[model samples]
Target: MTSQFPNTLTPKMVEGIKGFNLCTFLIGLEGWRRGLTLKYYSDINQYSDIHTQGKKLMGRNYSLQSKDKIHYFNQSRGDMVSNEAVRIAQSKQKTKDYLEKGNVNILPSKEFDKTHSDVDIIKLAREIGYPVIIKPTYGSLSKGVMLNLKNDSELTDALKYVRGQLGYSNVILERYFEGADIRVYVVNNVAVAALRREPPKVTGDGESSIEKLINEKNESRKDNPYLAARPIKIDKELKDVLRKNNYKLSSILENGKTIMVKNKSTLTQGVDLYDITDTVPEHVKQLAIDTLNALPNIIHGSIDMLFDGEEAVVLEVNASANISMHMFPTEGQPRSIASFLMDFYFPETKGKSSNHTNMYFDFVDIVNTLKQNYTNYVEVKSLPQPPLYAKKYIVTGEVQNVGYRNWIRRQATKRELHGYTKNLKNGNVVVVVASHEKEKVDKFKRVCKKGSKKSKVSDVKSSDWTKEIKMGFEIKDNITKKKKEVDKKYINELLTELKETQTKLENAKKMQEELRMERDSYKDKLSSIRNSTSWRVTEPVRVIGGLLKGKTKVKN
Candidate 1:
């Protein structure tokens, strides 16, 4: 919604922020509504908040201070500190103190015993009992965690796994909770967003391999900031889950099938964060605020919660929560999280709700939704490049006429770069551009390679040429011949192979079915054998005794 943040910081970081919707959240709703521009103040060495931009425009500053001694510099109002710092500082606490408070609740936790080895963890497990959780003392976002320890062997495995993952010298073990996890975002003693996040689940197609299916899911999340945190790994746990479900990695899953590889709501477990904004009842919101207030130095964080019926337990609180992705929800678009932050930061805006509301509805909301979906919706125009320096970019592969060329044309024109895209007879795409401002041109070329859906660019070559073109950006007519379809002979051969593979698959299914029947038949016989004491003890004992005595004499 807001203009793509200019190259205020390093381009990569800016780009990263843009991709993750971080800058969008920072700007807030009022910023969007008023057409608040993000400008790089050449005067200050650091990034300024909303006020500095206003000062540059109005040729003055709006200053104000609060009871807490935090400063805000503005255009109409000038410098001073505010009371917000005091509020933020009040809610902070040391991680150790927070962990020690676990005794307040029945759930178990411990300080890492510095002198203890893996064996000590085992001893602690025995004392505490089975099915415990092992985690790192200094960790965030479920970085180093393990669950489901049923016995001493499993405890050892969990400890080893946790230690290896964290590379930590010591770790804490706690009781594992069997319930849904919720993250409640609290700001100023009120619950803003209460989300119920679930581990990612997918319907099986009864054809593709599990590994293949996982690849598809992961790739689909390339544009998702949080989903990218989870990487697919095949380990013993994955195998164990398959075995427990009576499935093999080779087994084809049926449609509408769901599988959970990990239990926790961590991104590594492929978490699906649901927007329960409307669903969170009043009591639940109060409970979350109450839980945070109970903890020290814990404002502006997410409460880790597990609820059973009406009862809920607070696992922990995260100070630096990633509100960007959570704000721009995948489903059920709610009020902007940025709106809350802006109003919270500038308390004066509280009384001006009508003004802010008009801006939000009139400008910010609709424009942001559109820009988020398509970055190019707001075109950026570039300044002219001089003859001394002309930038040229050559891109190859299935890029031309597949929407890539059009994208390049738009970006080049916006950034004020002069470029031409053409299709080669060999089907490769070549783009040449000359502009005075090369950085904008370079950015254009970069975006061109990663164009919209359906553009599959493989190779790109860029260079600075002395030659310059006076004309503005233009889209040259470029077309490539389509590849020939498979011949009849090849098609027949492929069909035959497919039929053979299908037949083999059918036979494997039949074999599995037969094995199941045999297993059930053997299970019945074993049940009868266990129940038949007369045959098992009396008959067998007598026969064995007679054979032992008579066989001894017969052998002599």
Candidate 2:
């Protein structure tokens, strides 16, 4: 009934697109879908570095342009968002100070540096009153943020953790506000979406221990693209929550019982974000928009707040909020956060192109190339413009392993096409090619009908293609299994899932056979017992005893 978190993250989860890279991808994809030329670069050599997985990945920069309109971005922070805006959002003290100066309601707080010792910090807390929160003045996101310290003991430990352990010299001590913590996303002065933030928690099903429940939740998180990167870790914060609630990892949480496992509502710690876009009070959303405007050089992004009683108070303004979270909320309908961002940056592209697209550039491959030292920088292949002519050829009969895909790839390359040839799981060769000339696409159908030299083609069925296609033709086979060679993780994920399913099916068959054998043994033992003289001899006595027992319990 109990379990351990194998680990916070899966082996391959963190290696793929994540964090800032993910944010930039979501936005860039939106632009790419809109028929814009989107390119992913390792780094332009004039940006900050993002440290992740032991390697310092320089700014995952990208750009979206169509004609004279172009926008460069370092992750989600676009070039239009000034460095001053980033600095203000990054510093806790500056955020509160600027909001107050703008007459925006903020929690009362005071800031301090290394000059203030532990005793000095505690004295300042007493002056500010109990039930306060203290965090680093600069970094570590929510790791050092401690809320609801009702006494000196909790405050002292919080101070020690942030200052000593975290080594953050400058810290801010603020009165912890009470209410539902939420984040409101404002775009172009519009309160586009709102979501409530809650500490990571799990509801009991009565059959599972708290630990088992946590593991199950973690498994489900692996399915979510946004949640998969961050995990519900069993750390000191989780332990403190369990201790306070008188629950243990082995404790069986009764059905319908919900308990918070982590204090801070951070995605890194498995915090949950629930979309309340449609139902949140209009006034609260307006307040979010006003607070966002209070910050200079920032026209949009998320605003952290607390709905304290009947009113709302701004906690912080995000200059570069991860729009991916809004696009993929844990509950409720997903908002068009990425679309709204596109509208803000490129107003001319509003409602011009279809929302759906099958084509996507390999952003991870670009970053991998940078890390692998293949290149210090990679100028990603530019996406093609719209009004493209596309077609798909499904060639069957001795197609696979006969260089059919390679031949098709060569033919498509010769035609100056942009697409790929792949071997289908059903032993068919599928070639999808696109070009600006419809005549070329129609002409390729005749070439595909002839088939390759070693291939005996039974049929060649062609269809008109409307979905998006990346620029360039390549053959996808065992030679191209590298993650960098693929555009999306969908192919790898599907293959791995299929392999796992096959293994599970084999194991299931073995289990079923074992159970069948066990059932036969039980049947044989029962048959023996029924055929024995003892069973026959006890039959009459057993019937009489049963009759008597039934009469005694009967309520007539």
Top-TM-score structure, candidate number = 2
Taken over the whole model, the C-alpha lDDT of each candidate is 0.55, 0.76
What is the C-alpha lDDT profile of model 1 across 1-556, one tens digit per residue? 1112121212222223332234232333233232332221222213334223312222122212234433332321112212232233222233334444533232576656467788877877788887887877656557666666788887777667777655865677777767677777777787878777776555589787776777777776554444555555556667676787786667667876878755555645666666776787676677667665655544445667776547676666554455654544434443344455545655644533222221111122223434354322221122231222455667777775678877777876776665567666677766776654556656766675686588887777887754324235666653323322345657889999999999999999999999999999999998888789766668778888999999999999
User: Which 10 consecutive residues of model 2 have the lowest summed lDDT?
Assistant: 1-10
- Tell me the tens digit of each residue's lDDT in model 2 across 398-438: 98878778788888888788888888889888888887678
Worst 10 residues of 1 by lDDT: 1-10
Error of 2 at 260 (Å): 1.7
User: Residue 170 CA error for candidate 2 (Å)?
Assistant: 1.2
| Reference-based TM-score, model 1 | 0.51
Best by lDDT: 2
**If scored against the real structure, what TM-score would every candidate get?**
0.51, 0.77
